[model samples]
Target chain A: MSRVLSSKVALGGWIISSLALAAVVVLAWASPAWAGTTTPVLRLAAEVAPHDPGAVELLATLEQPREPVSSGRVSLGGVSVSFSVRVEEFSGAPLLALGTAKTDAAGIAMLTYRPTWTGRQAFVATATNEAGTSLGSATTTFIAKSSPQSFAGTVEAVRPDGAIGQAVAGVLLSIVALIWIVLLAVVVRVNLGLGPSRAAESSGLKS
Target chain B: MSKENPSIAEDHACDLGEEVTEPGELADVRASAMRPVLETPRWWWPAVLVLGAIVVLGIVAWVVQVADGLGVAGYNDRAFWSIYEADLVAFIGVSYGGAVVSAILRITKAAWRAPLTRIAEATALVTLPVGMLFIVPHLGSPWKIWELVWPPYWNLSSPILWDFFAVSTYLLATAVFFYLPLIPDLKIAQEWLDPNRPGLRSRACRRIYKALGGNWTGSAPQRRLLHGAIGLVAIMIIPMAVSVHSVLSFAFASSSRAGYLETIFPVYFVVAALYTGVALVVLSIAACRRLWHLEAFIHSRHFVRLGFVMVAFGAVYLYLTFTEYLIDGYSGTSGNAAWVHQVLLGRYWIPFWFYFVAAGVVPIVIMAFRRTRTARGAVVASGLVVFAMWVKRLVIVIPPATEPLVRSPLSAGGVLAGNWGTYHFTWVPISITVAATAAIPLLLLVLFRFVPILPIAEMEELAGPEERAESVAVPGLSSGDGFRPAAALGGRSLAASTSPPSAMGEEGGR
Candidate 1:
């Protein structure tokens, strides 16, 4: 009776230990996916502020909600952020790359963009890790009232007046005209027998 | 000038003694000059047909290009201007030789120029138009060429506009220059024709000649007027031709591209034109001499003299090329240095060395030695020079055009290491270029059928008392029944008599 009891205890302990080992193996295999699912989601926010006459300052904040914070702010430094702008309101309109900025210690990225035309402009800021994986993105809108006057005026001023070019062209045209006249006059003279006659001279002045 | 007169060979045996007059000698000149016009050789028709067929193929290719697009010609955004531009510069550049030979020689009163002048001037007359027509193929929409001349579409700042004005003016001057000399020869050609030949071709030829030369009587006053007019036109043409090539260079130099932006391009292009121009003249003279049996008139001395001229210009062009490369390379600006590298050591090295060997070194070598300084040597050197110069123009045009002016953000390298574009020539451009080349000889052959191959009156005038006196004492130059030897003519040799002994002595023996 004692031997049978000891054997039953051994068999029970072997089965229980095997079950524990299998459980440990399964857990080890699934831990990474579970950890990935539990990772903190990144969030982004974008804001625009008028800086200069034709330029506006863009600020984008990137934050991980579950990350440890210092002084009540999420510090997401060294992450690259790209800024884009779309003047068209349609859904399929392409986003033009405005510029790129990097997040600072305060988890905020800043860029200065000069608006070319007066309209409602939609801005997008995207955050990406070193491997170029997009972490998160944000969108914002701003209405520009008066188009920059100096920009238009400056472009117009930079255009050539063509004064000297026209003068040179005029002179060349005049010279070409003079050459044509001289050539034509000579041709006419040759046709009209207006020159001295070598034949008459050779004929002993016999007309 | 009668057709019943003995063949040039038989006529050579007759002894006029010391009493041979100018009229008798001039009659021989006229007979020899008009032979090609009066008699059609067996080879003439077949050659014309072949050349014409090639030209037709070029036209078909052009049509296909117009129907499709410039893509057929391997044109793209990167290689927008390539072969046709080179062709334009080259063809136009070759015409300068004719002007230099005819006009400059006329003004300088080089009497030896008489036999070659007609060939030279006719060459200019035909080639300038052909060169101008290259603009058609160069343009993406050739039909829009009218905009170039139309006033409202004119861009005053554009070098192309000035190029048009300059080239057109030069063309008019070329036509006038060609026509003024032909008046005297036209009279001779008309006198040679049978007044009552039954065929329409004969009648038409007579009528055309009559209309062109009816007013020309070769009177003293007419000669004076013609001479004065020719002199004035000759003087005008030199500057006009210079301006045409200068404006052509300006078309490149005005651009901000690396290889093209040099201030030296104008002088460089002008010298290249003169060099290649003389080469074409040599080739023309050689062809005429060989094909028409003008060996008696056009001699080895003429070739050697023209070869000397070619080498002088070649030396200048080579110097300019060296300086252009050195300055651009030494400065080491990204664009300029990259272009220089591309030409000298990179993708274009083959053509660059080809130019260096053919145009730069070989011709100089040919001109340097007495043994190789024959008509044959001149022709060989000229063929090489013409071909090589065309390649050099390509080197000048393509490298700068294919170079990447702006750097790409995606690329790791800067502008210096930027990707260079290539112009791959398809059959369209090659056919057109070959056809244009063939048109040169084809047109010359056909042209000489209507006009005298030699300037008969000019040769007569140039054969003065000293020449007439020498011609009588010299044995008949003909050996057997064919072309005569250059040496037998002795002091009567037109080139030997006129050219400085220093220049003609080495080649005069032949």
Candidate 2:
């Protein structure tokens, strides 16, 4: 192939690859269920299960903005959705996440949370798929209660707690510290007399 | 005795030439510049005392603020960053004027810079720390300031983290740059002090100067090294300062806020900083001229020249201001259009108008008109610019904050909020700001007492013979001119010219 044509081909390939990567990110965020819709509505409903009053049933439904799916497993099959259970204290502090769970092929995720705090608590379900693509997102909040005998199902943690992020933050901070230390050292070193003897000091008054 | 001895005072004027042609003449100039340090002024103690009280009050207010929350200073969730953030940017921004002005003049080999360098450098030196202190107050949790440097809490992508890094680096560079030029002057000062002085203060000052001057054999190689180092630093500091303020602007611009999101803001902030910074340098020069009686060294021409520079930046900033608003306003973005309307016609209209007229129009008019371009006029213009610039920063910060996050078209249901959320004026920030203002001159006063306010070595270097011949001949008879050539001739002192002023005038007149 000619150099010019080959270079053009390489450039074209790179552009296509970047676009594909971006598409993947968008698909991962919005899940296949969004299908390029701007707003994906995630309805959250909190209820005390009839059989186990202590276990709060949290439900999240994924759909377009302003479009609510009918009751009982609407057909958002294979679309991934996550539901969060948060406990907020009465003092107005931020919501602390209790647990999270992903939706099954039935377009519904159920989180059974047993709250430790007695005050009003909120259950928020947010859809991450279709998040970065200017596609619509749906976040619904429902205040629920949890007291005694929560279900024995495993709780999936959804809170952002990352050791790598914290470590990165530390390394960034040390750069500033290094700058200060270097500055302080330079000041002290210079002020303590870094150069040769003064002309006047060597030869009295008459320069 | 010279305070009352009219002849001694008259002879001092005779020596007030722009240049020092001979060694003895240079000695006379050095003696005159050092006069303030050697003979403590009667007004010094009183000024220091008042400034000290203001500083103390500021500290007390900050303490109370820490005791109370940032809310005591009128901070709220809606207005998380307010006056203190503006103050941090303003103080740091103004220091750039000093550093850049001094560095540019030095790099360009401007002769007039000799009298102004020390003052400029000292201003930068003092203001950087004060500016840094303001960040503590700007933070909700001042105690967590250490977390900024602790690394683990840092986010490399975060603008705030980079802002911290940039400012700290700039501060270090400024300190180094300030000290480099003072090295030779320190040597001169150390040699001038009498070892036999009895008072502990004088002895201590001497000792300090001696230690500071260490082994500066004014050898050619040493001078070259010092000059080269200063040059390198001077070159480095300009870019460092630009980066510092650019990053600071990023802390705002990187935000999703409508007013801050404009791409023009970084340039706008930088230009505004330069304008205000130059005005501050002019003010400092004028103040030092009057307060230290440095009229001989820093003359009407210095103010006029510095005034021109200030006006130049003022013009650029005014253009930038217009461009910034015009672009945003013209873009027809609902959010930006609302912000522009709010700034021009809404609650913030007062500060905006004041800044527009006072800092924008007034300085250009003053400097442009020859009649009002004297030292006094320039000082007034500079004073207005300084105050107006502060208000401008307020205008920059507050409008965006007060504008409802949810903006609509100006024609829509209230483009601007009927009543904006308040970042009210409280005693805490007021006291702290006043204290910071007071601290600059106070620190300067203390700094000059230790180091000669003039760069003596640089002065000697610039004092070429041709310029000296003119001042020696003219020997103007103004009351402000403390020396008279006629008196010098009558006394026949070795420091004075041998010929009469009339004779020298006739010789030079041809």
Candidate 3:
């Protein structure tokens, strides 16, 4: 013990250990960044004869794939563009959305309204280009006729080792773990014995 | 006719090469320096040949796996990655342990590191390539190995691609680390090689020496440059190793699977590697001792000290295992908790316990006690520590993967779910993995047979003529009477023996 305390040799273990500890703490405490969202606008323009000022075009916009948006005709660009649209709700909750329709080279964006009883419906419009994507619309109150529906899921006979095999995989997992133990033993032994090259040199000089 | 006292051995070491400025009264620094050239041991050559055959067999096995299909070895969608990956990790992680121990010791100036540095560095060099070869079989398409350099697959986002880069970088770094220190040693080996050995080998040696040595005729400037180079490699290596293990751990962690994905996985892997790497080194050193008759060079003290390192890491690993389980289990996620239960108490309990007992507990206990702190104890402890670490690795990989991605097929009542399935290991992969395992030591033997075992210049400087004829002061290892037999730790209680080497390494001068 006296030999080392009295010796003038420099000890650097503390420096490295500290650095590693600090770096680990810094990384661990940090959190992952959240993603951003872009709201895209949909331009809704339709070809309609100018003779009918009150004439509304029946149109619908689906903001999401596999599901259509619900709402009736709303006033857009001085025309009623949306008609009676059934707002279908699946088990998964999807909120009601709205969109605005403006005029373009294509036509004046509009929603045509249709009434089942005598009530209000909602309309939505969506657009996409290089700039980004946007959704806008107005809500029309409405009542609808009752309807019926059904649900479905897949079914199959249970297989122990999966459809292919199970009895064999369990045995193999044990065997592999055993093998890992042996290989790792050899590797660990080898590295620990290899000492510091530079220190060995200096010690050689002192001896 | 006179026998030297234990104090002499204690106070002095066989200097490799240096002008010993001062030696204690009993110092005999030149005892082994001018002794004789070390002959290739008998068992080494035999092992090399035997290992060579195994390697050939492994190659054949790989071919079969390729020709017949990956089905020959154990892999299916359920266990898409199994033994191949675990083996890869166990093998590659060990290489980092070498880098950490050797480079860290060198930078820290540990005196005991002198004899084992070359061996450690060489092990790192040999196993890294074998680790890389593991990727070939991991591939669904072996021919697509080259895709690592192409687009898409080469996308930095992929961990496999990261493995390619990290492994390559580490390989290059370790090789340079090993080769740079060998310049002077190679020069000495060249001088000893007779004409019968051939001039091409000699010329090649001389040229490499010149290029690397670059006028390193033992001058102060050259020595400074060499020291600087060593320092740079040491610093560069720790992070290089961190990168290697972190990327490797990512392969498991990035998977959406619960047990496979953990925030602590990378650090856990690094610790496991450290534990296993030390054990491997201990085994090699013991083999070297038995075969080379260098017990005097590498004795019980060295083994005991390294055992301490293994034990330390083992303890840390156990804690991490607990932390992982507690956090995972307490969360009460059925999939995660069930996986833990399976590992700790299910069918896998045997291997897991074995790992805990042999690799984790026994070594630490043995290393913790002074009476059992002998060289033999160290050897046994190290062997177990390494074996257990591997078990830990395998456990790390399989359980979570086997739990069925969503629900167990057996428990689904009457319906199969998801893309669920399991894989089993076949004959081909086993043969390949074993052969690869055997091939490492075999190839290392061949490499070492050609390279000098010690740094001749350093040894020469440490044991120069000026030292034997005068008295000098060394660093911390030597006290007032260094190795005087009377000053030996005679009859010291077991308590003294079991203490960590750091205490003595830092305070031995007394």
Candidate 4:
């Protein structure tokens, strides 16, 4: 049998790619988000719209669009008044649910996109492996705001500090999605068997 | 079976003498007439399908997790991290072993690695992702895992961010290490495969053969280059595993949490990972041996060698465990001591002790002694090691988390100062983890279906000059350490190989 496979250039490619991937990883650690401290120093605070002192705006910085950030960290002696937000069509798909899982489990979920499906975005929650499936899921509809001119351009709260703030939510949402997409792409690339050999693989099959 | 002669005493002394032969001869000697053992064991595929269904269930759970708020699971103010985080870390940590085996073998220049490196490397590649996926399951908004990329302060100081870096680096590195060596293997596969074989899978082998191996003919230039690349990556991998495990340990250490703050954590995690990783290699080797019918090539002696490595790491891990408790325990530091106490004597006592005995001591005994150091013993030891390491992760994560980071006196009740909450596993996290576990062998089987199981070039290299001769009729496995006298008695000249003997003793040896 003749020796038939050459290793020079391919080996070089493997070396280069492994190095490049590692470099990217080292770069990834340079930044951090949470302060690693447990002080919980008021992440988010907002002013109440409609101006009622009792009608509080979302209190926490990390607020879900439809869920209350915190149900008034104040003692409401007797009243069990709840808070909520409107769900509307955004990118064609109507809202499906209007609630948040526990804060530590899921900070928030969903985006309101306009879709051809006509049902008024009901929180169609089905039973999971758990009971009390109906304890959550409330239908939230948005108030229809007609366009000022014949041509309807999407306009609501534009200012960062307006009656409603869009910056943080949009920014945070985008960041999460961005990580997902990018990481997913990277994961796909790795799984699909791209680029050089490094130290260890999950399985040690010497080829 | 002779009790007088004591086969048990000879179990630990498996030695390969100077049976070094030409690559071609070894290939001809061991080559199977049939095809690759790419198909999963008959039961494995259906099990994977069941696993797939469970994974779908996890997806559905994720949908609920997304639909409802994050609170639907056991997340609360106190129990911010629950089973999901532990499962993620534990699974990822386990992958550390797979990577280390390949790196150690490559670094030590262990010729036996020819048959195992790609599998180990692929395991690391797959499990790291699965471990990383735990990050998704752990996250309230897995989408925010990207925030790791652009932290506001870009605090290079944080461990979690470092974890992100370390794991990704290791995974990428392992992938390349695994693929590069296979280039020649692919070429060999491309050449020998019958034309009648169906295309898709075999086609990738042929393509990979041409594209990567690039006219490799086992020429001196090609051999030197391949060996050179493997050597470099071997050295590179140990550091990568260190970095990965260190950062992982740092994730726990960076916090002031009592259980996680020990300086010993990084080293401890690294050793534990190696220990478990070696065990996995042994198990996998045994499995491949049986499933693929490679008994002639991979003898029980190989398991013994792997068992020896497992024991070495297991001993070190035990030492670290003691040090972890001793330094912290003797100091009487309330937080550290309390956490240790809880782990050793509290609710989690059983798991902690279980891991200690199983992962730590039992394997050493079996490995050290001849009576139980056979292939069967090694398999048991390996399975124990895997289970023990998993339990050890639990022991490591939960206790410290249960202790209070900040001391707040009990509120006029016996409820204690820190309400360091305990975590419970939910179906969602459990299913996800199971799905990942099942996917491992399945994906590997699929991969081997398309790729060669052993590094063809490396095997030829290991077999050396006699490989081309194709007439060196030596059955090395039968020549146990005391085979010299036997061969002389049998009137057959036997040259036992010496490579496996020397390398088997090193914890650092692959």
TM-scores of chain B alone in all candidate structures, in the order given: 0.86, 0.85, 0.82, 0.81
DockQ of each: 0.11, 0.09, 0.01, 0.01
Worst ten in a row by lDDT for model 2 chain A: A85-94
What is candidate 3's CA lDDT for residue B175?
78
Error of 1 at B145 (Å): 0.6
lDDT of 4 by residue, B1-510 (tens): 112223422432323222222232322311421135334357656755776776677777776665543445545434566566666766676676777787776665554455566656767776777778777767666666776658453334455666776677667667767766776555556556555657686566556656765444443444445556666666766877886787787778878877778788888888887887778777776665555544434545567777888899888888888888888878766676777777888788899999988988899999888888788889899999888788788777766665655454544332235445545555655666677776666666666666766554454445543431221233432333332221111111112222222111111112
Tell me the spans in candidate 1 whose CA falls farther than 4 Å from its real position: A1-161, A194-207, B1-27, B408-417, B466-510
Query: Residue A42 lDDT in model 1?
Result: 39
- After superposing candidate 3, which stretches have Cα over 4 Å from the reference? A1-207, B8-40, B195-214, B408-423, B460-510
Q: Give model 3's docking category.
A: incorrect
Candidate 2 falls in which docking quality class? incorrect
* Candidate 3 C-alpha lDDT tens digits along B1-510: 013334334432222222211222112112221112324455766787888888888889888766645545755435656778888998898877667788987776554565567777888888888878888887846777777667533544456766776677778778777866665555345445443554564566455544444322343433555566677777777877886788899888998887887999989988888878878887776765454434444545667767788788888988998899899988867677777787889856887899889887888888888777767788888777766777777777777666655454566452223332344556777788788778767766666556755444443333333431221233433444332112111111111212111111211211
Return the number of clashes found in candidate 1: 13
* Per-residue lDDT of candidate 2, residues A1-207 (tens digit): 699999999999999999999998888666645444234556677777667755667777665444343453334544544555442212233345555455566567777765442223456665554332322234445323232333479755334437996687578567556656755665555443343334443334323
Error of 4 at B124 (Å): 2.3
What is the alpha-carbon interface RMSD for each candidate? 12.5, 10.4, 20.1, 16.4
Worst 10 residues of 4 chain B by lDDT: B485-494
Clashes of each: 13, 26, 82, 81
lDDT of 1: 0.75
DockQ of 4: 0.01
lDDT of candidate 2 over B301-412, digit per residue (tens): 6677788989998999999999988888898776788788878888789999999999999989988887787777788998999999999998888777765563334556
Tens-digit lDDT string for candidate 3 (A1-207): 777864533345666788999887776555211111122123333322255422335343322212222343222222223322333222122233333444434335554432222112333444433234223333333321111011235534233345334444445335434434433442333222222443355345544
* Shift of residue A45 alpha carbon in model 3, Å: 67
